[model samples]
Target: MFLTIIVCGMVVALSAIRANCHQNPSVCLQAACPESWIGFQRKCFYFSDDTKNWTSSQRFCDSQDAALAQVESFQELNFLLRYKGPSDHWIGLSREQGQPWKWINGTEWTRQFPILGAGEYAYLNDKGASSARYYTERKWICSKPDTYVQMVQQSPN
Candidate 1:
């Protein structure tokens, strides 16, 4: 009878450990970001309320371990459009007057959206349309990949 109780207790303890590992953040695997940042499709984004020139905005994002947000698909583009405030916002697209537009991450601009002008930097206008200009001060969005996020192990409460 003692042996039976011992075996049952061992089983219960093992079961509890497994459950804790699965439910506790200390042992679980997940992706996360800093407060106020939004996560989508394995990426984290920050929409800034402060307006800055294109170059300054890009530098700010870089300081946060991210780059200016790059819209790679129509779905993502639409998502930004919907959430963007009334004012135009800076994106990662930029180029010289006659050069091909490129993202800050070194990717060529996708043709998913029409370029409204031959400006140096691209932004979403107040009407939810994309336009390019060099010196406009606008709010900006920053994005970082999941791999850049720090994985923390939390102690179970």
Candidate 2:
């Protein structure tokens, strides 16, 4: 029932943008995200309850066809911080010994959010983000773009 309402709302939204979908295909349609994942904007997020080391946390997300969450802006970070509850959850940020922090996709971390404290792997906590050794066991967040979304092209009569 809840999903039906969401689908109906998405259909209304997609109707407005369907024409432009050919140019910016990613945002075109379909809110049919995976069952357990939460759909926000153009991405789907999963917060795990089970604890694991950073590498193992990432591995679990990989099995779900997603990667550890990456924050692009303050708003996104806040959304994560708010929804992540009290327990800290691993994100996709990490650094090699004495190297720069990078996301799982290998993109270098920017000032989008500050990394407080000291650890090689990053996690979401009350303070937004904090570093911890990769082996530090904790819950994790996984995310992936809403690539399953697609617009069904109409055939001319």
Candidate 3:
């Protein structure tokens, strides 16, 4: 009985430590899925190896229990940009037609648009950031897993 009590106390303490250590929110998702992904502001993100159209990329992210990243804040956007790979990857936002950008999931664009570099947008010069279409083959960013998130496995009896 004493040993069991000690183990229980230890478990609670350990869990508390884990939660406190990741309060920054930026690293919350990372704590859940470390392999092939990183966490930022309560979301996990993963870059794809294969390039696809905007619609197709959204579908791919859906299949993987994630969605295309939604840049909700400048800090989050900067985080994405800093960690984003060298290759011009597609993001979930685009002008589609006129001025306002849209998210692939139909969420209203709440985040400020990242300043585009020359020739950077959509299909025109994906190597850079200028056009606004889905046909472009630039690499893209996707969110972290939203369901069945893997957790720290407990020891077997």
Candidate with maximal TM-score: 2
Please report the TM-score between candidate 2 and the true structure.
0.75
Backbone collisions counted per model: 0, 0, 13
Choose the strongest candidate by lDDT. 2
- lDDT string, candidate 1, 33-139, tens digits: 66788877657888999999888999999999999899977888887877776778898888866778888978787677886765788888655446556567889
Q: Residue by residue across 1-157, what tens digits does model 2's lDDT show?
A: 2121133134334443444566666554545577777877667899897999999999999998899999987878988998899999999999987999999999999868788877899999988888989888999999986643323223111
Predict model 2's lDDT versus the native: 0.79
TM-score of each: 0.71, 0.75, 0.59
Instruction: Give lDDT: candidate 2, residue 29.
Output: 51
Arrange candidates by TM-score, descending.
2, 1, 3
- Error in Å for residue 118 of model 3: 12
Model 1 segments beyond 4 Å from truth? 1-31, 147-157
For every candidate structure, what is the RMSD over all alpha carbons to the true structure, in angstroms? 10.7, 8.1, 9.8
